[model samples]
Target: GAGVSQTPSNKVTEKGKYVELRCDPISGHTALYWYRQSLGQGPEFLIYFQGTGAADDSGLPNDRFFAVRPEGSVSTLKIQRTERGDSAVYLCASSSRGWRTDTQYFGPGTRLTVL
Candidate 1:
């Protein structure tokens, strides 16, 4: 049973590029979440999924941000036309179910740097 994991840990790219950040949650857990953390601020919820469906994605900034959990265990966050403002730590987390009330386990995160 693995905890949550994210790749790269750090990503540096120019503006307008596209990047896909990955997340792997614990086995048997049906809930997954994605969030972005800017410097000096708390993590902001971007999306959360239960099973194969996106339970909530209202936190997504715009059309440029998207995510998928096709099989309900692994998730990938896709950012199109990466902007300077998009530079932040992309955190992935998971819990036992589709509720945030429960403690969520977080990944190391992928820090995106847009220049």
Candidate 2:
């Protein structure tokens, strides 16, 4: 429809808690990506999904981070056992093609604060 939409613009949680961040990509865009941004650093790639399968997920720090695009349109990023170090802005993006296409649109990130 419009651009990517993220729910719960901000979140506050305690350590050991879990959080799920959602992303709704642009219509007809088949390439979706997730990124995490910490203070004083640019966004870091967390995963990339082409259609329903993940094309790349190497940027995910560990098993605690996971993503899924079961329907190829909306995706979700799941964080398990939240830590203070995990606090950051979770960004979602979508592109017409794939990596380095120069047309990726990013969403207003969900700011997660782990207390």
Candidate number of the best lDDT? 2
- Measured with C-alpha atoms, the lDDT of residue 53 in candidate 2 is 98
Whole-model Cα lDDT of every candidate shown, in order: 0.93, 0.94
Where does candidate 1 clash, by residue pair?
none
- Please provide TM-scores, in order, for all candidate models, with all chains considered together: 0.95, 0.95
- How well does candidate 2 score on lDDT at residue 13? 97
* Collision pairs in model 2: none
Model 2 residue 70 lDDT score: 96
Cα lDDT tens digits for candidate 2, 1-115: 6998998799999999999999999998999999999988999999999999999999999999999999999999999999999999999999987758559899999999999
Q: After superposition, how far is residue 96 of candidate 2 from its true place, in Å?
A: 1.2
Which digits, one per residue and each the tens of the lDDT, describe model 1 over residues 1-115?
Answer: 6678899889999999999999999888899999999999999999999998998999999999999999988899999999999999999999888664888999999999999
